[model samples]
Structure formats: C-alpha cells, structure tokens
Target chain A: MAHILVVDDDEIMRALLSGMLRHVGHTVVESDNGQGGLEQMNAYPAELVITDIFMPEMDGLEFLITLLEKHPDSKVIAISGGYKAVNACLSLQMAKALGATDIIAKPFHTAAVIRQVAYALQSKTIAYRRRAER
Target chain B: MNASQSEQIQNTEEGYPDFAKLTEMREELGDHFLLVMQHFQSGMLARPQKIRQAFQNNNPEQLALEGHSFKSLCRQLGLSQMETLSVTLESMGRSGQLDGAAPLIERLLAYGLQAHCELQKYCLACGKPSSVQ
Candidate 1:
C-alpha cells in the first residue's frame, strides 16, 4: 500500500478521503490546504497526493507546480466541483496541463475514487518502468 | 429555480442526510463512518461564519472559495440540496454576480443548521457522540 496525502480546505472531504484511503490499507496524511499539504510532505513525504483545486491559503495549482518543481515525479490527482461560469471539463483540463495524473469531479462515487487512485498509481508505475528501460 | 422548488428540495420527506449514500459509506468504512462524519459535521459548523464574513465584505472571490469548500462537504455527506445551493453560490462569486447572494447564503446557512440537527439525531440514534466539537 502506498502512502497518500490529502489536501482540501473542506474538512469533510478530507475526512472522507482519509477514511477511504486508510480503509484500503494505505497510509493517509491530512492537510487543510496547499500550504499545509506541503508542510506535511516535508514532515513525511507521501507517494501520491489528492488535492482540491479551489482552496484558501494556497490553491492546488500552486501546490502542484511547487511539488513538481521539488519532486517532478510526484503523482497527483486534482479534484474540483467547477467554479461558477467555468466548465468542469475546462477546469480539469487545466489540472491535466499542470501535471495531474488524474482528475475526479465532485459528487463522485466512492467506486470512482478507488478506481482513479488505483489507476493513477498504476500509471505512475508504468511511467517509472518506462524510464528504467530507457 | 423558484423559491418553491428550492424549498421542496430542502424539505423533502426523504430525510436530511442521504441514507443510501451514508449506508454505502458505512459499508465501505464500517464503524469509521461515524467517526468521520462527526469530524465532518464539526468542520461544517465553522463554515457559516466564514461565508457570512465573505458576503459581508463583498469579496466574491472569498465567497466563492467558501462555496467551493461547502460544495465539497455537502457532496461528501450526500446533502444534495445544500450541494446545489453551494454550487450556485460559488458560481455567483466566481462570476462576480453577487446580486442575489445574500438570500442564497442565508438559505445555505439555514440548510446547514438543518443538516446539523439531522446529524445530531443520527448520532443519537447510533449511540455515537452527537456533538463532536
């Protein structure tokens, strides 16, 4: 099981994601926002991070950019409910461009979360293997 | 949507918290559902103040941020009406259209309180701590 970091301003989302991650046998760390997420990583780095796009005290885009600058290979999953006047797909596309390994929209099913997390980790493994071959 | 429709969504006889979703979570997380929900509810209690402040200050960005967080929290607990309301409010903040945000924010607050009461009832029924704070 991999260690995962969860960063979201909403406490409920954090708790739900943490409980779900832990239930699946992975170690989970919680943070309220991007800054806290970075601090947690410094305290104990995680293999993957699931972060919300809109947050106070450091949004996910800045978090993703900074984390990648420090550790380019860090796996991330960006989530959002879409801002008003902004299409959800468009927002997720921005996340993908920013290097999110995967994206999950809000009001997601639990199964989807499991599937996406597993798939993201698998994709990372594949990328790592490809690099080793080269 | 009209006020009647909004009221209908909030006061549906089906109950406050979505049972099907909560049951699914309970099945997946087992006893941890109660613990997680308790923590979630406490966080929700603090949201109104931030939202009200943002609205008062006419900071659409801040209001949108609060709405964004609220939307996510409501989604987690399966509070569909609250989720919808939050999404609308968030959109207003994002688009800088604070025209009707006050009433909507107040409605969101009302639903939040209602949800909390429902959660307390659920906790009491399950023999867990109703007041997690």
Candidate 2:
C-alpha cells in the first residue's frame, strides 16, 4: 500500500519488479538507472526504493548513499547479482553500510521480495510512529 | 524455460526457465504474469541485436553492459543456462578479456533464440499471440 520506486538498468528487471509491486497493490515508479532513480525520487518521493547494484551512469551503492544523504528517512532495498571480481557478500555488505534497509540477492523469489518490502515498510511505519510520539 | 533450453536441459537432468517456479509466480501475479512474460519476451528479442552490435564494435564496456543485463533478465526468468553464460560473458567483458568472448556471445545468442521459441510456444499454449519477435 506504499508508493515504491524500483530501479534497474535492465528493462526486464524494471518491468518485473514494478509488475510484482503493483500486483501486491503498491504504487510503483520505475527507472532505468540510478540517475533516473534519483530524479524519480525527487519527483515522486516514494516510501520505499528497490534498486540493483551494478548499473551504468550511477550504480546502486552510490545511489543508496545519495538517496540517504538527501532523505535520511528513505527506506531502500539493495539488490544485486554481484560481480565475479567482487565477493557477493561484500557487495551486499557495502549496500548495508551505505544505508540500505534490506538486501536481496539476484535470483530472488517473489515471496522474499514481498516479505522484505513489507518488513521495510513496517519498520518505516514504526520509526515514524516513534518519532511522532516524541 | 525457452523451448530450446527446455530441450537442452531435458536431454540432461535439469530444465532451464523452471516452469514450476514460473507457475508459482503466475499464481501469485494473476493477470500480471502475462505482462511479465510479455516484457521478458521483448527483452529476449531486442537484446541480441544490442549484444551483436557490441561485438561488432569490439566494445568491451558495451558488451559488459549487455552481458550484465542479459544475466539479470535470465536469472529473473529462471533461464539458468543462459544466466550462467551471461555471467561468464559479463565477466569477460569487465575484465577486458574480449578475445574469447565471441564464442560465448554466439552461444548466448543461440540460447536467446531458443528462449524466444519457447516464449512463442508458451503464448500458443496460453491461446495468445506470441509476444516475442
């Protein structure tokens, strides 16, 4: 029920993620790369973001850092298939350090995606509630 | 899996593009499954040209991009063999090892064609027009 931003350089991935999110009743915004993702975020200001790690123009880690810097409250899910030159765990760890709320590896299942999104959104909601109480 | 991939795997013990997995997705996604398949089919049809153009130009960066994109698409669709091949091609491109990339690229293209055929078959089975070229 949240507005979600899905970013990936692959059209198939963008379509698939957005489709999945929309199927679950989330409003979805899609972008082809991180720059486009940043622009979309500026325009739409989604409650959650799901992004791929490796992309042209700007990759996921940089995007995560930039997003969090601009909107510290932004909830992000970093997804990557990883690189042969870099360890997969390391890629994910970097994403976490950069402020991703969750990480999903490539070859992920639909249930896992839904679960993570829900968890991230719930976490955001709880955090917002706590802040409002203060 | 595409028909060729299914056949390739059937000859062995595994099937590319796991129909069982896709079935689960279809059940969860309902009508959206058609949209997913349609988008995937379009990628399968359009990407080979981009890959070929990258090869013709001997552009490792372009090849790497295409390889990475192909790998992601294949992994999402459960095209295991093609995913593996794309990963290899992606690495080769990234590491500036383009000399041996031609053979792999050819194989990748073949797998794409096979997957496209499979998409056609799937559309037919579903009583819809083929979404792929």
Scored against the true structure, residue A78 in model 1 reaches a CA lDDT of 90
Q: Model 1 in CAPRI terms: which quality?
A: medium
Candidate 2 colliding pairs: B1-B17, B3-B118
Q: Docking quality tier of candidate 2? A: medium
Scored by CA lDDT, what does every candidate get? 0.78, 0.78
DockQ values per model: 0.60, 0.56
Worst 10 residues of 2 chain B by lDDT: B6-15
Candidate 1 residue-wise lDDT, B18-95, digit = tens:
867766776677666787878766755677667878989999899888887777778767887778777777777887
Index of the highest-TM-score prediction: 2
Candidate 2: lDDT of A65?
A: 87
Best by DockQ: 1
TM-score of 2: 0.86
lDDT of 2 by residue, A4-35 (tens): 99998887888778878889899998898889
**TM-score (all chains, Cα) for each model:** 0.81, 0.86
